[model samples]
Target chain A: MTRHMSESDSDRSPDAAGRSWHDMGGLPAGGINPAEHDFALWEKRVDALQVLCATKGLYTVDGLRRALEEMGPQAFESMTYYERWISAVTKNLLETGVFTTEELNARMEAVAARGATYGDASIEGASPEGET
Target chain B: MTSLPHVDPPAFPPPYPSAAPRFAPGDAVRVATGHAPGHIRTPWYLRGRVGRVERICGDFANPEELAFHRSGLPPRALYRVRFTMKEIWGERAERGEDTLDAEIFEHWLEAAEG
Candidate 1:
């Protein structure tokens, strides 16, 4: 995709070289994609995980934001909102040694292989209190 | 609040009484230019930019400190700083009418030297 930057855009901010990923103030925002404010199923799951983890005292909102901000420029630019959230949450979990990279990869592989049966048996027990 | 021994306190309170806010509404100020690690709410675009304090939104726990799980002691006064898009984006601003309002904490601001 072509960036809508002007010829003098770079000269405007001499210090842009050191600016962080979250600094997108004057950059080419292209048109706002006017999609309705709708969350995909997986996006909803990501949001639920964030809220649940925070409620359980695992991490603070600020902590999660900091993790997202620390993401590499490419990943930060490429990810969707919920994708960034999940990536940051997972990074936090891994950094704190709550789980290892290997374990996460293995679980992903297992879920992919098992597909429909991955969490079927545990769904009843895993249902949050009072939800059923 | 009951919490696991390893878990940090979730609530952040001022570690000490904050000093009186230095500036008031309509006061001219400039965002300080500095970079530190961890969670910083100050947007880089506003750094070193001059703006007027629209209003004092009162004090709250310093989010920068809270990002590291520390008590945001002596909550910094939060201000709604108003700036024209031209001020932030210089000649690159698309429209002269476009404006931006950012919530900036006192620690990130200083009396406008200009």
Candidate 2:
């Protein structure tokens, strides 16, 4: 197979001088991985939320793409595809004042705490008894 | 009870006869270069590179404006630009037959000066 794209010998770190995250043009990507797989649970959730936002006319496809493009290069490089999607969606929501940062953080903390106590009945859906 | 909202993509502006197509197929053109603020659809690698117009792909709503949720007016012409791998990657390409074709908007291209 022919290899046309190759990165320089300099640091391969993202957001390096002279290259933005979106400018992956000729940069070496090791090699294209042809493997494909079904979306994970979280990935599906991200996609559903994005579709919901679009359906509600809360944001356009271009708007979401632009938001993804503007992400910090390091964060963009480190995040998985769906992770980036959720990040962009959350950023848009915050910018539009759909919810405050404090509220988001507190909700995340609550979910984390609930997850720690797997069988805690006080949290709905945490135990079979709670389900009833 | 609620129904799904009907949303349509941005509409294309009616064509103006006064604005004729600029570049033609086989015409040498250079992709525009320089810093631009806000969202842009043009790829960074193609910027400032010279290529040939493969064909006119027709005018469409400008994605740059659409990024901000505005109706892209005065639709921009879209063209398929063909570039050799060497032209884009310099001496980095392993094979000479490699090439890339991208659909670029008219605003991002200029007539290549001989």
Candidate 3:
């Protein structure tokens, strides 16, 4: 199959896409297709951040920014995907009214100190009762 | 207090014809639309779940701008519905600990008898 670069290809190049995946030393791109690997990684990162937000109650914009930064380079370049994932999680957090911005920030700082590092965490905790 | 001149209340505007109420606070529903190319607030877990609506938040409001996208109109009336975590994870939810909230589009729901 001939690889044809589209008009927008210049803006969305593989190099741009690879910035995140490259942190893991270029996952089997030749054999397994790096873009697919990056997407999978991106999906997993989203799941991890969702748990962090729900359990730790880190649902503010600043809190999300901190979580993304903690995600390191691999999850950073896939920022667009990260934003979408957080938006979904934030909507739920707001609807449930579990934690406020101040509480979330404090939780983030505490989680950061625990050396939680990068990985998915379970959102197993008390469910927030509906308010408003 | 001095009495003011009586003024007729501003003419009430005609009420919009309400859309047919499909799902209620405890009805199962599923998303009819697939993942589009642009920004969307719906999550992957509630794509095909038979969950219950917890609250009906009216009208679309852009969630991205509220978070980070900083663009797009406010999302339409969003519904905060509850789904058994078991419905989403199938056995993942422990006994008596099974529920999740999904911010779903109004068009994405249909009544399902429990």
Strongest candidate by TM-score? 1
The per-prediction i-RMS, to one decimal, reads 13.2, 13.3, 19.4
How high a TM-score does candidate 2 get? 0.67
Total clashing pairs in model 3: 13
**Candidate 3 C-alpha error for residue B22, in Å:** 4.5
Residue-by-residue lDDT tens digits, candidate 3, A12-117 = 2335432232223212344643564334443676687777765664354434543343455655456566565665575557545666778878887887787754
Per-residue lDDT over A1-132 for candidate 1, one digit per residue giving the tens place of the 0 to 100 score: 011144235533636655666766656567877778866656778899989977876767887888877786777568888888999888777766778999999989877897765444443356587466
lDDT of every model, 2 decimals = 0.69, 0.69, 0.49
lDDT at B34, model 2 = 49
- Per-model DockQ against the true two-chain complex: 0.21, 0.25, 0.03
lDDT over C-alpha atoms for residue B101 of model 3: 67
TM-score of chain A of 3: 0.32
At residue A123, candidate 3 shows an lDDT of 32
* Stronger candidate by TM-score (1 vs 3): 1
Model 3 DockQ reads 0.03
Fnat for each model: 0.38, 0.48, 0.02
Local error of candidate 1 at residue B7 (angstroms): 44
Clashing pairs in 2: none
TM-score of chain A of each: 0.66, 0.65, 0.32
